[model samples]
Target: LNAAPGWGTRLVAGAVVVTFMASYALFRDWERFGPLLLRHPTLLALDTLFGALLLVSAGPGSTLAYVSVCTPFLAGLIYGWRAAAVFASLQGLVLLLVHATLDNPHTGPAEALLLPGLCVVAGAAGSSLRQLMLRFTEATRALTEMRARLAVTEAVSAERARLAREMHDSVAKTLHGVALAADGLTRSAAAPDIDAARVRQQSGLVARSARRAAAESRELLADLRRESDPGHGTDVLAELAARTRDFHARTGLTATFRPTGGPAVPPVPPAVARQLLTIAAEAMENAHRHAGATRVEVLAGVHGGLLRISVHDDGRGLPPGTDLEQLRRTGHFGLIGMVERAASVGARIRVGRGTRTHGTEVRVDLPLAALTATTREA
Candidate 1:
């Protein structure tokens, strides 16, 4: 495992160094020491061989004999600083004792002590170098992770801003147009030979469109509010049902809502809330104006960490547009807006006629990741 700061590494490193030095001292010439090699055979072999080679090639008189200092350096390189220091100190003690008792009886105490004393310094130096490298590596790793997280955050934030702007231009503007159309139809009723039947039909369409627009506006506003104040955490199902009821009350149309297994309080972030509200409102509006529907149904559920909102209206369905962009520019802009919002948040919206409803059905599936970004802001 990477060297995490914990008691385990300290204990293991300490024990390895202490046991290795102790066993080396206990059995300088025992065959049993070979089995102890199984614990950390490579390090044990290297240290022992280096010490033996120095003893053979460089006599006690030569300063080059101190090349055996590599034993502690190797321990530090493999384990860490603390272990390296302990191993170096232990090895130096063993050398001093061996030279005093068996190898250098003719030499003065100070002369015999010089090589072992240098070994102690070399061990400490090795440990310090390893610690510095380890610290640098950890710092670099942490910095890289933080930068990657920041990049994702920035991209999500930018997407949210673009989505908000599009909703204002498309959904909000369409609602404004519907409100104007309703007021105009009501005023024109004062004129004679006005084709009352056609005017009433247009009035109904205008009223329905206005209601959908208002609901969309409210939902979008709620999302914006959530960004600044997350205290009003709405239940997604309740909000959908409430919007449907308001649609019925405003337009004198029959609208129903059914929800299947969702959280009492929507776990959606503010960004998703905005996009979901936009799609639902747009779907309802299209049904009211173009489909001439008397009944509308809103359904909501969760699937695969996504919130799916569906709006179905029972009215005469229109043909799919050949030039979606041209239609949007003329007046039917909400569909385009809804699609863009879904894309911004890594979601998808499906628009089709309902099986039983005999009118348009728009379904939006919003990803949970879009909401996760706003949750932090909240």
Candidate 2:
């Protein structure tokens, strides 16, 4: 995943890391009894299988005794605790039988306890190394995303800076010319003739209207590229958290806010963010005030290139017929305002029953396209 960023490669990387760590448990004094195990092909095969299973077992302090434990530990890790437990039981039975049947000097009860005591300290080191590698990979992915966002931000800033500069020059000049024309018209209104005065006044009014339209267009563009306002300039997740806390405190209602997708998402435009937050706040407040809700939950995140936000409450729900049209009759403009805000941002809002409880759920879903300046205009 670090290289190709695909799940196939990611799975391969995971397997490789797991194997590398699993190999640390394979180091035993295999050279010492090579002949005896080799002479008996079956024992040799058993030894090989034992070594394989050793990778999964958790040994206290020694490798030799707990070598048989690997199969169960690995089974548990791969197939879950039940499989691990079953494999461990079989391994323990075989180990006990082997030790008891052997008449060799190594056949003591304490010798049989080796699997229980194998330190497997090397495995811990392997686990730590694996964790470090995974963390580094995550950091690298995050860095890549941040770099992409930075590039987009720089490009946008440059464009906005250019537009702002052009607006200042062009609009300023237009207004300046209009002011000069108005001054000249007022001074020249003495006309010296009725026809000249009427013509000048009509011409001046047309010019004023034309200038006003140009000024309005400039204002629209200016609003698009405006500087960030105080609170909305910060992170959206943090804003949601603060809002959840404030709601709980202000209304004495239980409120929880959580983010999905990932820890850090790309920044949202300030105006859109503000409207979304306002809609969220409004939904939550209405739930508490009108729905008699005691608990509220809000989720905000961009998933599948679509921004999704949901505010759900666990109190009384709306009638089954409630909808955009039905809402107009009830005079509850809270839902209407939500729909309007979402519509203004080129979003789609859905109102339904809350999943947490049988209350109201106001969900606003905005396509990524809707959040852009071009789509906003459309």
Candidate 3:
């Protein structure tokens, strides 16, 4: 017998016992006792010693003698074939002993051997059932473990993608600017009539760009090591204004930051603010590198219970048929990252022509309720 059976195993055993009891009631002539055993089959099944006594009293030729076979079958289910064989043997010995004591002339050699044979067969059948149950249990456990492993793999892949987007947006963009400044410096040095003051200024711009790139790289590493949000306690509008100034300094393009409908941008969660800042910076970078724009403007404001941030440039607008799918095919993930960042904080992003219907505009709109809800969840 199992020392401690699980609920599943117990359920299987109970179902078997119920089936056996129903068969006994249908076939045997219990008369008065039939109703009692049928009413409480649990008593008959659980009390094995009492069942054995009933077998002894019923004698070898009695129909009730077949009920003794259930003992070995139950043994097989709980303790395997070896124990089933032992119980079957013990049941046979009890029947032979009862036959000798009673001296029933009608109980011949064939009758004595038939019931014992049936007991052995029942034990084998129960053992086979047990093996099937064990296999089912093992398969279920393996499937559950496999699903857990798959979930972990997916989580790791997502984290890697997030890190790639961070590198592309911050360190990679800054380094690209640094390269442009270095190239400018090299050309200025090679010029025969190089102005001394302009050369010094170009050299300073290159140095500043390099330092900024290094700082961004170090910050990325620090964020990884700390495993915490890097945007906590940051001023969103101030950072955007600073990035706009830096863009102008590096690219010598006219970049401006403006707050419309208010003197200051409305307060938002630090993490949401950080994502907005990054999105705006990416739009500026695109304008400088791809649009050939001379001027760029960043606008921020709260209107009608919505926070809206927009970047506009005076360069040629986005090419026709330029969508996220086409950008992905071309290995450009900056806009994809911006969309994902906006989605993370319950915002909607739109990329199209600027307010003046010239150049391009990237705008993000977020509901004030969503911002408050996200803050509460965090």
Candidate 4:
């Protein structure tokens, strides 16, 4: 596997083998049929028989026995350092046995040492080649994965931008039309043919619906931007208070956030806190825009191992027998969205009159256990 793609390394290894073989022919009289045949026929027979070995490598091919160290060098390139070491060790053993069995067993040790030195160089080259190949594969794999993620991110961004443009063109235009209709109804409200009371009510409803739809659109856009982000440790009550102040600054309504329970409350999960804040904002907006409330109160704290959040306003309370599900049919989804938001965190929601004033009160209760379970599932 390592050798197949490395054309340069293969060519270099082949050249080294050929060079070694040429050197052997120069010094060892390799052109002769067999230098050892006349004086040591038994040695020649042993060499030939061992060269064709299947399980043990005593020497190289008969044509290049003097340069047999090249066998281990090539093996190093093909199978790395381990194979090189095995072949080199076997070659050394064979060299010792052949020289010892020859008539001139004491031939200078320097000539014998040259082959082992060449084998060491070959093994180092092979090991370096394998290391380079491994690095190339890993870098390629990382680059491919990064490209895939980049493509997905670009596609998602393009799609979201397209969707936002379409919604602004269609839904935004429709809401603007609703505002125009409400203005026209107000102008004609005092006419004799028009019942002023009914016209005012219809205008208020139209204006409120337009505002609610616009708010939902803005929240949808915000959610889209934040969808892929991970959660963080945020103080739920502090964040709610910040949002409350932001809401007042945006809508010019009197909004206040205050914690009810003591500081012993465990930190609320980010998901649960987000839903609670969204629901509270919707309730406060409902009171300010539709219920004609000047003051809205937001409370968040822990009670009975549950995260308790309540939004109360000094405005006319909900109508008798108000059904949350039916609010969508009447084109008033503010309350309905609040309920859904609370439910998303496995919380209970209730809408009723405030205990201290003649106004609406919205309470959301999120049990810690239920919120934890929902967070896990999500």
Q: By TM-score, who's the top model here?
A: 1
- Worst-scoring 10-residue span by lDDT in model 2: 54-63
Candidate 1's C-alpha runs over 4 A off are 1-67, 77-81, 101-111, 218-377
Could you give the C-alpha RMSD of every candidate to the true structure, in order shown? 16.9, 17.3, 19.8, 24.0
Comparing 1 with 2 on TM-score, the higher-scoring candidate is 1
Over 47-163, each residue of candidate 4 has an lDDT whose tens digit, in order, gives 334442311222222334555655566556556688667666666666555544445545667755665566567666766777788889989855644443343334334545665
Worst 10 residues of 3 by lDDT: 225-234
- Residue 116 lDDT, candidate 1, scale 0-100: 80
Residue-wise C-alpha lDDT for candidate 2, range 1-378, written one tens digit per residue: 122457655654564456546455433544654454335545433543554333223222233345445545444433444444455555665555545544567456676755533323323333445566678998985674444344334434554565568667777666676776666666566556547856667567758856775876667565554434322232567788899899999989999998976534545665566667888999999998889988899898888766788899987888776677777887878889887776655566888884644888988765554334322231
- lDDT scores in order: 0.67, 0.62, 0.72, 0.64
User: Which one wins by TM-score: 1 or 4?
Assistant: 1
Candidate 1, poorest ten consecutive residues by summed lDDT: 144-153
Candidate 1 C-alpha error for residue 169, in Å = 2.2
The parts of candidate 4 lying over 4 Å away from their true place are 1-231, 372-378
For model 4 the TM-score comes to 0.38
TM per candidate: 0.45, 0.39, 0.40, 0.38
